[model samples]
Target: MSHPQAKIHRMSELVEPIATVTFSEVPNEAFLALGMRDYWDGYFAGRAAPLGQAPAEVVHAVFYNFADGEVARHIPWVWGKITPQEAIAVRERGTAAALRQLLGPLVGSPGLVRAADLATRAAVSAPTEGRALYAGLRTLDVPEDPVARLWHAATLLREHRGDGHNAALLAHGIGGTQAHVLMALSLGMKAEEFGRVHHLPRARLATVVDGLRGRGLVNADGGFTDAGREVKERIETLTDELAAPPYDVLSADELDELTAGLEPIAAAARGHDD
Candidate 1:
């Protein structure tokens, strides 16, 4: 079981990618000039899935949950923005450039780097016997360029893990309101902000809160009760279990080497956000 405390260590690397990799370092002026679809096309180009061909709703439903109905509305517009091949090329160039800039001497370790990339990609490229999201993403064509393949591979794996988490959440009967409410502290999101973004109605949340309170799972403020904390920990541990198969593709030593090589790049990427 993944200890709840264990999750805290991993989140620093995961939380920002949806924003940074998508648009954080990107200049607002560029998006204004290019338009939304072009911006997204550039941002999301390489993946195991042709999200470009996917309806916005499909992409939104899979990615950003459609609960509040806010972010996914732009999907159709996003899908038609560019050819999959063009988008893949654009994505690969960007990854190669970033690797050169951030990795420095580590660029010499291309085989090791590629192995690291493949380890994570295994989640998607391998048969999705049980993964709902991985199976869906695997339908898209893999990129031919090595770097783009790496980028796409990592992303699909990341998202596959995310989807697995959602499934775990559902299996636990933790509704969206309770899940986000519980995650506010865990995810570093303010409760009010999370509620707003998810479009969770206060009244609905109140009812859920009441249920949790009755179960001794939460307090009046929706803070975790001891039982609540235990439940949350279990859910997180299960999520990690569901997401673990991909990393198993690498031996312990190989995985460590990959993490070491990627750490500088990941840190640099985080620096861009900071």
Candidate 2:
């Protein structure tokens, strides 16, 4: 078997498209019902503030991938007051509805329940990390609906992993712009996509890019330097470490089963991307 940590993460990635694509693309109807952009802002703000109040400030924090206009649109709204249960409720409604829509047609498909079961079981072991954002969400009551149960599990797992990633970023002294840039370098995310998600001006981003090059973490043309690659690799290794607690529940064959189940579902979700 691969390293336990790697196997855990390897299965984790299989479930990510549900959030990035399905949950994201599904109407903000749930958020709208909760107060639209304000709820969106407050919900993400609460989750991102796990480490400290306004951990990286409202604008540049990466807990949720807000759009370019998102920061400008919602920054003035009240933050730090949104409760974790409130956020989780809103999140679960949207995610559960979206998954039901996306995966409903194939309900009889083999391995779906097994896949969700893997996530749900993994979640039982994931909350040991000392991050408030994750810990807060962890405290929410889980749903009984099958899809909602799966999404809840996936959410716990995602946030748990994300909290760990944020912890790793902070520990390495990496800031927001550079952190996003590192994601672009390692994951092939586009600068335009990052720009859309972060409200920072180009000049500020350029300065960060230049500094990354100066520090030998990025090349002149905005790719990873060898040193940067090493750092990125180390961060991923640690993320896997933090993320592994949940997946410890899954056997190697089960991990493979979950991955296989999510593959087609992820592809199906991506198929609808516009």
Candidate 3:
């Protein structure tokens, strides 16, 4: 059997790729470009502290409206100290105004202008299967930023793998059954034990268990096959290596504040089976 990790490890050893600037990169620019100009200044204005000090600040500052800031402050610190709903309303109004300003000339008629603006926004923001596949490719930790290699691996896996029900589960933020089974076996779970943890019926789970054995993604007797173990270890190593470096200049107090808000998100991600 072809070793999956050999390819993944080669890919992982490459550099991080230049993904399109996600909303997480520049909150103000992204929001404004998305026609949320009112939220444009709101990001920087919302707080004296590092905005991430608040839970969901990343989501709100970039993806949603900043009108949810609870503690009110000045122009530079213009935080919205209100409910999420209020913040959303403020964001909507700001976005509408910005779109009107940008598109007003082309859309001479006001009614048509509004419809055209909404249509444009929808087209820009709509998600697609290809985009999801692209996002998945972007998430892989390639060693030397070899995005093409990672894309190749994903392509290979998709073409050769079992039915995508398990893969879809992984994409949906649920752990992949196959991945979970591999993990359980890595942890030395017997077939019965693995079945129990997954709540799979003996017959169905055994089919997965046997499938893993055949693909060399798991092992007989429910232990990690050599290939399986290597893949899991390399993935863990790559995850740590690929994570953004901690800020060097952060004060102890500042670090604590940042961690407090981010800890939960990290924990939830780590706890994911896939």
Candidate 4:
């Protein structure tokens, strides 16, 4: 049998793409409908809407990955263009439309309904302490539609795990830039590409890389050194452990059923994107 933590980890991997489709694939038109012109504007506003007009500093603290000042540039400003409730509505409608286009008949299948029910159970049962994003999301009403429910559940679980991940990073003494550097190195991504994605300047990226190299975490070739890999593994393992409590509400068989039900849906989402 898979380790219980491993099963929870698997659930996280399966749910990630579905949880993030709104950020990655949802059309600009969705945000445009609210008079938001920039993607990041919509992204910061929509995701943080659960927190009800949270300030930039609050967003930066919870988001945990953006470069310094990156969040401040959009937030508060985004709130001016759209209210938190409006942003939430746009995110839900857009995400639902996107899932329908991607999942087709799977959207209405009994399998989806079962998976949504199971995932929502686990999500709602998760502990909320110190998980600001997840706690914020949990306060919202659950969607009545299966597709929307599944998507919302995925988001809840995603943010729950993400908040735990931030804790793991903190426990390891890893700052946001340093964490991104470690991630890029682990994924074999070019520093330039990762830097562009996170809006880190080349010099700033190099500085963080150099700091890691000083700590013997990164090698000369920009990959994780032996110690670096171990640190990364430890962080991921702890993150999985922290994320496992929610799944405890499920019996072993129910966990299996939830994973099985989500597999095809996640695969369909992947295929659509690919």
Best-fitting candidate, scored by TM-score: 4
- List model 4 lDDT by residue over 72-168, tens digit each: 9998998878899988998998988888888988989999999999999999997799999999999999999999999999999999999999999
How displaced is residue 19 in candidate 4, in Å? 0.7
Q: What is residue 169's positional error in candidate 1, in angstroms?
A: 0.7
Q: Which regions in candidate 1 have their CA more than 4 angstroms from the true location?
A: 1-20, 27-33, 37-52, 80-125, 130-132, 140-147, 187-190, 193-216
The segments of candidate 4 whose C-alpha lies over 4 angstroms from its true place after superposition are 1-3, 195-199
Lowest summed lDDT window (length 10), candidate 4: 190-199
Q: Provide the TM-score for each candidate, comma-separated.
A: 0.70, 0.77, 0.30, 0.95
- Candidate 2 or 3, higher lDDT? 2
Q: What is the C-alpha lDDT of each candidate?
A: 0.55, 0.63, 0.36, 0.87
lDDT of candidate 4? Answer: 0.87
Pick by lDDT: 1 or 4, better one: 4
Q: Judge candidate 2 at residue 164 and give its lDDT.
A: 85
Predicted structure 3, TM vs. truth: 0.30
Q: TM-score for model 1?
A: 0.70
lDDT of 4 at 10: 95
Q: Candidate 3's error at 12, in angstroms?
A: 20
Pairs that collide in candidate 2 are none
